[model samples]
Target: MESAELRELLTPEGVALLDSLPPYTSSTDVLKIVAGLRKDGYSASLVATVLTQAKLRGKAVAKFGDFAQRMLFTEAGLEQATRLPVAALHAGRYVRAGLTSVADLGCGIGADALAFAGAGLQVHAVDADEVTAAITTYNLSPFPEARVSHGKAEDTDLSDVKSVYLDPARRTSGHTNTNRLANAEDYSPSLDFAFGLAEKLPTGIKLGPGFDRDLIPDTCEAQWISVNGDVVEVGLWFGPLKRDGITRAALVMNAEGLHELTAATDSTDAEVGELGLFLYEPDGAVIRARLIGDLARSIGAHMLDEHIAYMSSDVAVSTPFASTFEVVHEFALDVKVLAKELKSRGIGTLEIKKRGVDIDPAEFRKRLSLSGKNSATLFLTRLGERRVAILAQRL
Candidate 1:
């Protein structure tokens, strides 16, 4: 957001108006609210700012929960901010490690910094953007131990800090149209500088979940985290923050709670075996962390194909790391024949899953001519060189 818009939003009148506004429902609702405010003699700029904030708060619920209502956000800041539950986990690491003070470099809107302060740690939150820093200061106003600075992350003094948390800016400049920077060197503080800080002190560096595996340092612990089936971020822990003998880990969090799988070394791929009674699909975090073999061993399963992540087991087993499905039928992957078979079996609603193959599920679904009362999940994949289809029921 621009400075003038931010200044207006921070005014007492603006705060009162925003609080009085109802929760945003849709674009039409926003227009109606804006028009009503304008008709009530509120300035156009004030109405627009309040509407934007109302919209942002609605979107922020998934990340910050109820706390989002009191917080302000930029489009890009909210988009890249860490979820509150996940941020608590990050704070727990420092607390468990006996660190009391943290320097949160590149702290966007102070989301992670808020978590740190909430965990009772002193936080020095820094952001290069002026508007972002202002928002960060506002968001962190409740925590006296947390301070926001508008400056480059690399320029921040960390000599007195117990540890550091670096979340480099991974996108090019734009409020709502930001584009991701694919190269590590393109990050605001640069990966080299971030890694250097890690080498100097106990540090946690957050990067994209799909960060290059080869670029990871051998001395640090790399943990990939997923929330509600979506792989979110990979955190690299160095120095005192690194867990002993655990170089890689996968942490999955859902409504049930958080579960973690770790390995001291890279896990060897599970051996390929014939299709068994049940098929399993490992969580995305497991695949990203290369811990599929460990998960497979825990459930007495084998890989369905050497090159594929799908696993097969003779017995049905419940595991948090993977979703289990019972195999109902196996057939050669012929679209016309498969469509005929599905129709004959009275299968109508279908969920198509594919791996190690080239097929557009949506386009292919149109050709199936689906019509029935039954629902089934179909897996289109390769068994060695042969293309195959496995119809399964979710367990």
Candidate 2:
């Protein structure tokens, strides 16, 4: 069929087909009709445009469509949601701390709100988009005392809220739309403004994971969260959740089922020395919180250098802050010498890790004639202004 016909078919019949089909993952799948028409030799763009309009209309009426797109078209929605840890890694902490109610401002598709409600907290979820608001209502239907409303966060009365969750819009456009009303600053919504609005109540604001440490305010506690070793989001905590320190790094993992790897300024600070034989790199969350010194002390390790994130140790033990690796072999520098050393050891494959070296890993491997059978981690670094490489394995 032609594109126009295909677009028209999606109005009711197409939606039924979609509902009947197995659940689609990406929101962009809602536009698959254009692709289907194109495969049948129809005008793709024309059909896509019509279908797009119809899809928006359907979303506005029924409150369901591309959630990320709806939020992105308005402002920075995509950037915020993807950057924040939406999987609710810290929900258990929130619940155990006695935070019984949450007002999820700009609750997008109600991902975090649903997590909170499922954790047995009453949720007052709000979104500016009418479609998103309606979707939140439907998405949150199973939760007890979960209420969804349509309005801008600034306009919503929050007197009943004891814990506030903010995931501000951060992307300027959809993949197609380019108009933007605000920049990163606008997406931030001002720490002062957040404190004033949340005032005395616990508040959590989700921010870009890569945001600079300087941007975090002194009054709030900053936490960098990592899930399964990926640095997912940075959370700013206010009121009772705030820690009395510079930053707190939390490595929350599902390993051993579900367990949190928490280390902060209070627990990590120690009188450790310089990097030793065994090198440890703490999780991204711990690094973000600047708890390297504390982590070193906790694990009885020391910093290799002032600039490097690696913590050195002569002994190895399983620790939450860092991954422990064993050093089984050593190689002296001079690319030619290193090549000869590896050859004598019958070593070939290499995993190169760097800290202060300017050497490209590929080039280093090529220079060392690295290619054969054994796999080893090559650490490139500077010890008292001298270039060196350490060969190590998991301890």
Candidate 3:
């Protein structure tokens, strides 16, 4: 949004009109609302800006939950903002360390700043984008301890703040449509600057989960975090923020609660063996953290393929680090034979998992012509030197 549109949207009349409107939805008749607002004499800019916010709020629920209702967002800012639950964890690290204040550098939409403030830590949120900073100022108005400002992260003075958190802009400049910056050096604050902050104070840097491990500084603790089953971000913690005795960590948060796998270094790969009675699918976070060897040893499982992430064992074990499945059938990788077998077993609903192979599951499913009441997981992979299919049931 332009500064003028934002200026108008912050007016009492604008806010009231937004609040008074019915809940925005996918089916919302935006054209009708625009026509009605124009007839009511509201300025075109105000109407357009408010409507955009309403649509954003509807989509923001996935990230902000109930807080999205009162919050304002620029599309790019909201897209880059951390999920509330994850941001709360970041804030908790500061609270647990007994830090009273934090400076949020490149604080998109003030999501982390909100968490820090909610956790009772005084926060200064800085964003380079004028409109995003304004939106953050509005989002954080509820907390007097939280301050928002428009400024470049590299220029921000951090004399008073006890700790710093940086999530550099990994996308191109814009409030709406923007392209992702693939190179870490191209990040708004730059990786060198973000990493260099550790020398001055306790710091935490949030980067993409798939960040190059080789690029990670060995001096700090690197942690990959997953929500549900998706690996989200890797956090680099320095100084007092870094936990003792932990250099690498895979943190999985789901309905099963929080599960962590930590190691001093990437664990060595487990010894490969024959296909066992069960197959184990390592969680994405675990794979990203390279602790698959540690996880395999814990569950008495071995690598199904030396080069693959899949593991298997005769022992049936329960662990949050990996999903367990009971192997039901092993057959040739031929599609025609598999279809005939599946049809004979009355298997209908199927989940296809592939590794170390090239095949599209969607296209493969159509050829199966499946019809049954039962559901099964089909694994397409190599068992030693041969390519094979393993039909299994999730445990």
Best by TM-score: 1
Query: What does candidate 1 score in Cα RMSD to the true structure?
Result: 1.3
Off by over 4 Å in 3: none
Q: lDDT tens string, model 3, 231-305?
A: 889999998888998899999999979999999999999999988999999999999999999999999999988
Alpha carbon lDDT of each predicted model: 0.92, 0.63, 0.92
Off by over 4 Å in 2: 1-16, 22-90, 128-138, 175-184, 243-247, 257-275, 329-348, 359-369
Kindly report which residue pairs in candidate 2 clash with one another. Answer: 76-169, 76-170, 76-171, 268-294, 269-294, 326-393, 326-395
Per-residue CA lDDT of model 1 for 1-395, tens digit only, reads 89999898899999999998877666547667878999999999999998898899999999998999999999999999999999999999999999999999999988899999999999999999999999999899999768889999989988878899999999997557799998888998988999898878899999999999999999999999999999999999998788999999999998889899999987998888999999999999999999999899889999988889999989999988888999999999899988999999899999999999899999889989998999999999998999999999998
**Distance (Å) between predicted and true CA of 80, model 1?**
0.6
> What is the lDDT for 339 in model 1?
92
Give Cα distance to truth, residue 347, candidate 1, Å. Answer: 2.8
| Candidate 3: worst-modelled 10 consecutive residues by lDDT | 17-26
lDDT computed for candidate 3:
0.92
Instruction: Flag clash pairs in model 1.
Output: none
TM-score to native of every candidate shown: 0.97, 0.71, 0.94
Worst 10 residues of 2 by lDDT: 70-79
Better of 1 and 2 by lDDT: 1
